[model samples]
Target chain A: MSEEKHQHVVPYRVYVIILIALLILTFSSVGITSIELGEYTVAAALIFAVIKSFLVLTYFMHLKYDKLYIRVMVGFVFALFLVVIIITFLDYLFRT
Target chain B: MEHAHHVEHPDMYDEESSKIGMWLFIFTELLLFGGLFIVYSIYRYLNPEAFHLAGEELNRTIGTINTVILLISSMTIAMSTTALRKGHKKVAIALVVVSFVIGFAFLVNKYFEWGVKFSHGIWPGSEQMLAEMSQGEILFFGLYFVMTGLHALHIIIGMIIMLFTIRGLAIGKVTIKRPSMLDNCGLYWHLVDLIWIFLFPLFYLIH
Candidate 1:
């Protein structure tokens, strides 16, 4: 095996920690579902979902180590997310 | 201030461009799904009772297990990419294969779940079955099958790509000198896994 080129690889322990964090979020989201949070239920699930997605993208997909241009591109995509959802909601609003 | 030659292929750019590209693509995918999720949310809000009934009929346990499997497979793919960056060919190959196997396992589990649902007259637009149910409930399952079915198709495509990459490595075409191919394959696999991460909570954990 050639000498490892990059700095020492991130330890598996870190990834395990991320996994634990996701599980905690998952359990908490499920726990909150039964509560009468009213409209907040969707918000809660989306919040946890966003957190989990961030963890996966940053750690598993190596975005944390990526360059700034990449970050900007990803940010732009997320910005589009709002536009798409809002427009969809507009359609829903008109129908109702 | 005079490192002009280094500007052409800086380690930062070279090491990260492919990943950035993958992120951009994933962003578009999220937009596409964001549209779908918004639609789902709207219809569910409009017809809460029907949505709840559909939710009650779903197989949550299987969905959770699949989510766990996909998450672990993602970790393995991350390890594989890291391994390759370090020129650990054997470990990288093994990890890739492991991820592929786990992905296939997910598909198999999903296959049976869908099969059961289909047999139970819960398929997309099964009028003979959903004739009495609210239109929203039928539409909910329709979108469910369409979204997840598209995802599964992507998984199948990813599996085939991984198998080819594995074969490429077996034939000495995927060495460090030509590592971009493997990197791209890993990106696609991770995207598939990422989609499943979102899908799990959406279909299974609906309130």
Candidate 2:
């Protein structure tokens, strides 16, 4: 573990770039809401949000550099969350 | 020599496992909010119009401000970790302090936002809301208050963690070689921001 302590020191420049990208995405989402895209408005905003969270999780949270097991754990948790959401929505959508 | 002897015990400093533990705790936090998000989706589907109306009542400007604030704070916390790793103790502490200040600003913004809502009689169980709002709209406000309120509570908790991390840095308990506490705190702060990333769109930009 100690040997891996020096693991991947991401350059400050990369952090800055990611921050800029996130801010740009944030503004874009806000702008898209005002454009009257009809049904796509919510979908667009949420898509931007998903991208922003992806950046945060991968870079800021250092998941990209984390151990394989940790990555697997995150993926598993997300899968479980998605399953729960889908099943619940199915129940609600089909309720007679 | 006592300090040197402490280093001999490998169990005393397992940064990898400590980080794994933090990640596990973070998963639980995600699921905790995931449940509320599920409820929100169901209610919104059932009452889209009411949810839209209720979302309109929220101040998008304030929400955007808070979003930017949290995003910048997230960057600062991340940079603080980098600074600590680079042996810039003072820079690291200053970054954490900056994040703390921004977090406080977020709460202040929240205070005014909620104050305006309360003054308008939009609070849960208010006679105005109960009498005038439909069941869906009422439920929308209820979830709004509960979800954002919980998120705000997390902001406070994250600040407290930062405070302790700053103290640890000041006293040399946290150092370049051993910064697991600071690192974990940064992860926690990022998690708070991550949650808000979703919350902002769901509640504010629902157009």
Candidate 3:
């Protein structure tokens, strides 16, 4: 838990590479959604959005280089959000 | 004078705790936006057609350009951290300045985008909306304004933080030895970009 162990500086090259990947993903998301995927449009777009956020989180935000607890907390928060979404939808579905 | 060491130890800067504090605040932000996402989902579900119609009215080209702007700015800010850490003070400040410029570009694009909508009389409570738009369309535009407005607010705040960090870097307050201020600022900016990643698809692309 010492701060000395955590100064792992990310490289500039790595940030540039991640930026290219993000731009490609952004363009692909737009392109894919342009093709009429019908009901799957939202799903496809959301999946791309999720992947983009993961990259931004893991690299740009340095979660990959951070402590284990910070990672765990972030995971838990996202999981909690997913559960909330599911329950809300379920409640919506079962309504009379 | 003998107690000076203990006093300084208590005042010692700790990056780990500082980061934890930031993450905690970020979690609250997640919850705040999560609530909005939930509301959006329910509304869209209740009126899919209206959501679709209103979503189509949005300009995807501007949305895509803004997305790229934000993504590039995010990278520049992240690279600024690396530059600062590597002791390239001038490069670090330069990258941050690039971020500031693109951030302003995004804001400018948003201004015009919102301006177009207003010219079309499509704001949340405009009379044209009350007279002609369906209730679902009203809800769609309402959420659109609120969600994007809040996000733009975050962008402004992030730019302000970057301004301070830019000053810190120039003045030697934010240094390689104590870089939490700049690091935390990067985290905040990336979060804003992350939210836009989702918001772009939800409000513009997924339609």
lDDT per residue for candidate 3 within B1-207, as digits (tens), equals 456554444556878888899989999998999999999999999999999998999999999999999999999999999998889999999998899899999999999999999999988789999999999999999999999999999999999999999999999998887789988998999999999998999999967
Which residue pairs clash within candidate 3? none
Q: What is the TM-score of chain B in candidate 2?
A: 0.94
DockQ values per model: 0.38, 0.83, 0.92
Instruction: Give residue B74's error in model 2 in angstroms.
Output: 0.3
Deviation from native of the Cα of residue A22 in model 2, angstroms: 0.6
Best of the two (1, 2) by TM-score: 2
TM-score of each: 0.85, 0.95, 0.96
- Pairs of residues at least 3 apart in sequence or in different chains that clash in candidate 1: none
Q: Which sequence of candidate numbers ranks them by DockQ, best first?
A: 3, 2, 1
Writing each residue's lDDT as its tens digit, candidate 1 over B2-92 gives 6656456544434345555656666777777767777777878788878878877788778877877877877777777667667788988
- Compose the digit string of candidate 3's lDDT tens values, residues A5-84: 34788988999999999999999999999999999999999999999999999999999998798999999999999999
Reference-based lDDT, residue B206, model 2: 83
